[model samples]
Target: MDLLIDSFVSAILLVVSLDAEMIAIVGVSIKVSLTSTLFASIIGIPLGFAIAFGDAPGKRWMITILNTLLALPTVVIGLFVYTFISRRGVFGPFDLLYTQRAIIIGQLILIIPVVTAFTISAISRIDERYRKTAMTLGADRIQTAWVVFREARFGIGAAVIAAFGRVISEVGISMMLGGNIRGFTRTMTTAMALEYDKGSFTLAIALGLVLLSFSFGMNMLFHFFQGRSRL
Candidate 1:
């Protein structure tokens, strides 16, 4: 009991002091997560908008596939990407395994479905009049989309934020694809896992605190935007 308390206090102190190692790991985690989220949003948002707004056939099936993918386990994605990037794989000649880019790729695949699903939900809720009104105006196809995007911005923002949270805290892909190389590909989650395995709780506790704080912050931001959108 006392040991746990002490460890947590020490961890908090490390965070307060801005420990260099902790900062580096956090930075790497942020970089990888944000990069993946950015790419996922770029691809997923437009794809989702198309599915929701377009008159394309098989839209229901596409949405089902995307929603199903949202539940895919992180390690499954890790393994899937590993197969392609491993030495024996076709793309292995580029040697992308165990690198930051590898981590981003894994995370990117992991979050694409999440972003897409959320986007679909967001845009689907829009009153049909918004689109009709836009078309009634002088808006072209692209301009109508921009108008819809403005209406759905809050929901889309939440989706992107959720993706950021998912990728930032994930361990399986980071460990499998990144190799958790210290000062390189190591992230807060992977570092905590390594520290725990090494029987060192300081860094682990610190990272846990950091992760909790980060998740809380993201959730707060999500709610804030959601509230504003309602207004």
Candidate 2:
């Protein structure tokens, strides 16, 4: 109990003082997570709209695959990406293994399905009349998509936020793909794992507090968007 208290107090000090190392880890995490989320949203948003509206063959199977992928383990994604990026692999010549970019790639794979599946669910919930009404008004395919897009904006925002939250909290991909190299690919989750293994409680606790704070903020935003979606 005393040890925990001491570590907690020291963690608060580290956070309040803006410890350089902590900030660096946090920065790397934020950068990787945001980059992955941005790209995933760009791709997933359009892809989800297509799946939701299109009647192409095998569309149902594609959605099933994406829904299954939402639960894919991060380690599996890490190892799968590693196979291609590691030396002696097909893309080995590119030297992507153990880099921040590598981490981003793994995270992007991990969350793209999340964003897409959530987006599909969101679009599915909209009234069928919205699409009919848009078409009745002579809205072209693109314009009709925009109408549904605007109506589903809140749910889609929640999807984006959920993607961000997923990647930021994940450790396996960051550790396996990034190699947790300090001053470069190290991230909050990786740093905390390293600190805990070293029995250095202060820094671990500090990062945990920071992580939890962000999680709280994310949950609040998620609920806000969810409420807005219902309206």
Candidate 3:
């Protein structure tokens, strides 16, 4: 019990002091996560809009596939990407394995479904009148989309935020694809895992605290956007 208390105390101090190593780990995490989330948003948002508004055959099956993907494990994604990026694979010539870029690529795949599903939900909930009214006003396709986008902005924001949160907290992809290279690809989650294996708890605890803070912030932002969307 006393050891646990001491560990927490030391972890708090390390976080309060903004330990340089911790900052670097966190920086890598934020960089890769934000980059992945940005790419996912770009691809997923439009794809979602298309799926939600366009009449396509087997749409139910498509949504089912996407929803299933939402539960796809990070490690499975890691192994899948590794096969393509590792030596002797199709794209292995680029030598992207064990790099920050590799982590971003994996995280991108991980969150695209999240953004797409959330976007579809958001776009679906808007009253049908918005689209009809836009068309009635002589708005062209692009303009109509803009109108719908404006109305669904908050919900979309929450989706992107949720995607960011997903990548920031993930570990399996970072470990398998990034190799957890210190000062480079080591993210908060990977670093915590390493610290745990090394029997060191302070840094791990500090990183956990930082991760929890990010999660809390994301949830608050998500709810804030959701609330605004209701109005």
Candidate 4:
């Protein structure tokens, strides 16, 4: 127990001293996660809105598929992307494997379903009366969609925040696609895993602290939106 206590103290001191390596890893993690989340939001939000509001025959099946994908394992996505980026694959000429971009791609795949699923739920929760009222005012389909979207903005914000939270903490895609290259593609989660494997707690604890703080901040933002929607 003494050793554990010493490690915790040392970790705190390292964090306070602003360890460069730790900071870099955290920065990479944030960059990759945020980039991927942004792309996911761009694609997922519109796709989800279309699925929920469009008149396609397979809308129910699509939503069901997306909901199932929400629980997809990170490693599965990593493997799936790895195959496509590998030398034998069609897109392998780009040499994207083991790069930060590769990790971003993997993370994007991991979060798209999450964003879409949450978006559907959020949009669905908006009162149907809003859509009815817009239609009664002689609004076109596009205009009604716009009105409904505006009313559900808070909920959509929550969906995005939730997607960010998921991507930030994921390690499988980061490690597998990024190769966990130190000072390059390494991220907080991957760094934590590497540090723990090396029996070092300083970097791991520091990254853990950062991840926890980020998750808490996202939760607070989500809660803020929920509160605003209630008003």
How does each model score on TM-score? Answer: 0.97, 0.98, 0.98, 0.95
- For all candidates in order, the CA lDDT equals 0.93, 0.94, 0.94, 0.89
Clashing pairs in 4: none
Backbone clash pairs for candidate 1 read: none
Writing each residue's lDDT as its tens digit, candidate 2 over 1-231 gives 999999999999999999999999999999999999999999998899889877879989999999899889999999999999999878899999999999999999999999999999889888889989999999999999899999999999999999999999999999999999998999999999999999999999999999999999999999999899999
Residue 22, candidate 2: C-alpha displacement in angstroms: 0.5
Better of 1 and 2 by lDDT: 2
Higher-lDDT candidate among 2 and 4?
A: 2
Model 1 C-alpha lDDT per residue in residues 1-231, reported as the tens digit of each score: 988998989999999999999999999999999899999999999999999889899999999999889999999999999999999987799899999999999999999999999998889988889989999998999999899989999989988889998999999999999999999999999999999999889999999999999999999988976776666
Q: Model 3 has how many clashing residue pairs?
A: 0
Q: Write the per-residue lDDT of candidate 3 for residues 101-161, one digit (tens) a residue.
A: 9999999899999999999989988888999999999999889888998999999999999
Where does candidate 3 clash, by residue pair? Answer: none
Model 2 regions more than 4 Å off: none
What is the Cα-based TM-score of model 2?
0.98
| Candidate 3: C-alpha lDDT | 0.94
Q: Residue by residue across 89-196, what tens digits does model 4's lDDT show?
A: 777999999999999899888889988887788788889999999999999999999998898788888889988999899999998999999989999998899889
